[model samples]
Target: MDAAFAEYLDEFTRRDWETLDPDAVADPVRVAVVGLGWFAREWALPGIARSAYTEATVVTDVDAGAVEAVAAERDLTGVTPEELRSGAAADEYDAVYVATPNATHLEYVEAAAAQGKAVLCEKPLEVTPERARELVAACHDAGVPLMVGYRMQTDPAVRRLRDLLDAGVAGDVIHVHATMSQTMLGELGSDTDQWRLDPELSGGCAVMDLGVYPLNTTRFALREDPVRVSGRTRSEHEAFADVDEHASFRLEFPGDVDAFCTVSQNAQHASRLEVTGTDARLILDPAFYEREDRGFAVVRDGTRVDVDFEQVHQIEEEFAYFGHQLLAGEPFHADGEHALTDMRALDGVYESAETGRPVELGD
Candidate 1:
């Protein structure tokens, strides 16, 4: 066995979710979801609605009609984002899910934290690292648990891959490759002014919207921060005047491991991670930190190993786990430091693209 894998196996063991007794916990958490947009409705709300550990207390959005429509359809109560921000509408719930645009995450998180409520904010916690750090510190001071929506961490396939790495099954990870892309919003007939294409709101184009997925997944899978980053980007449509339509970057980690990730709003579909290690290689397809139809693949010494897993909804599992952690007063899995790292890496990617040089991460 590889020495690093042996060491990991000695320190940590993979957890079995099935063996866990569901009835061991009490008091389902009351959760209020802010932002009833695309993701909030498609993934977040439905996932939470199906979970046994949480109650969807309220749904809020800037568009009252949108929120009210979802509320009526789902039989949920609706609150205005303004009301939520003013704290008058938040007292009814124990937690808040912030699914607003990237620019508004900090404000919503701050408001939620001020109410001493635990929060799960969608990815790229804030537009900048400084803002992310401030929000993190505020949550810390308020003694509220803050978790970013890196739902891949809760995915069984991802969990299994992490286990293999830790168990030395894949030996020492040498390099990681990832690709996450989707058709352009304009091509999909989406409004040109969609927040995702607005750099001012989404932070960047493809990088922040889809690139962050692979970026965060790489960091989580390796459990290391990139020391340096290099990247490039391009845009085809004038509507995406402020943001790139496609972007690619290379990241260098501490132990000489490297990761290459590319994200594009111009691509046909998406791809997952292809990790190469000294002893073996593992491939996770359709890996967007979300639930997948087929499971992940493990190859050891030229032999393909199939790891069977049930389709576990990441959003549901993540919220459930967060609720349990909150009830138990345990530290959050995706904490402030994690959110800041994502932003810092994002900053580096932008810097690298502009300067045509590798940007060293950190202040």
Candidate 2:
């Protein structure tokens, strides 16, 4: 290889690739999980159990029976949501992990904030941007930390991509293409009456649920919020009558960076993201979904080089990062205000789709 080319490659590889070390905290954060739904049971609980910096000390839900069963099975204290809100077991946990439906997030988050507990609310912040603002204000008023669970931020590959972009390895980013889809009905199998189909509970179907992966992931990688959006959506099936089954949106960011994103709840399972810049293109195929393996590559001058990163339990990393921030008394990057940006941008997408025009997001 030529000397100049070798030096360039060396510089590219040496760029800061640092990622959060979740095990930095010596003390674990005691957590009370505020919902016992399928995601909480299947992913959140297991992830907390495996995390080095956090542990589930209490569990609660609206359903008393599910709370009892989960608490017993996990050897955790069981409490009703009302009891938790009333501070009956306030001393048991230092934080609350809320995994409830979209619209119900504010209630549990307010209760947690009232008790001065840090909150790790699942994504979208809340059903609407207005409600999300309320939730953020609640946490701010109580002077407690509030983090939205955007697990992609904790993934090492995604963080590495961010570092590379920040290092100018990709030059000036020109555009991004992202799409995420899943066969929701195929996976759930006739459970069409679930809360996901209810607009009130889920906010929206594909856009709010599946679409946020690309939208938030791009924001994290680019460190830029979208300034405007144009969107389109379709919901044909009876199950999706109240919400969108397919949605597409375009985002305009600062510095002329634009993104085209698509999401579907009725399509075959897939996730892919690509960012093209003047210098090279970065790709993360099979992107958003939690997986045991992730593919990453960089293409420059028609030469493709794949990069390997450590495989991690994304949810566990999220829990550990939350715990580390709490134990260290550090400000979180994905705090409530950060989440509010995405919430507002998402609201813009919906408004644009409904009105058949572009929506501008205000700071």
TM-scores for candidates 1 onward, in order? 0.91, 0.93
Could you tell me the lDDT of residue 109 within candidate 1? 90
Worst 10 residues of 1 by lDDT: 11-20
> Candidate 1 residues 1-363, lDDT tens each?
446544433422133443334477566788999888777888898788676667788889889889879889988778777788788866679999889899999888999999999988888888878788888988999988888888887766677677777776778899999998877664446678688877778888798888888888888888788999999999887877789888999999998999999889977777789889998998888778353463577777777755555576678777777776776667777887787888988989999899999999875
- Cα lDDT for residue 282, model 2? 86
On a 0 to 1 TM-score scale, where does candidate 1 land against the true structure?
Answer: 0.91
Clashing pairs in 1: 5-168
lDDT of 2 by residue, 151-212 (tens): 99888778777777887778999999999988898865668988889999999989899888
lDDT of 1 at 255: 89
Alpha-carbon lDDT, every model: 0.80, 0.87
Task: In model 1, state the lDDT of residue 324.
Answer: 67
For all candidates, the clash counts are 1, 0
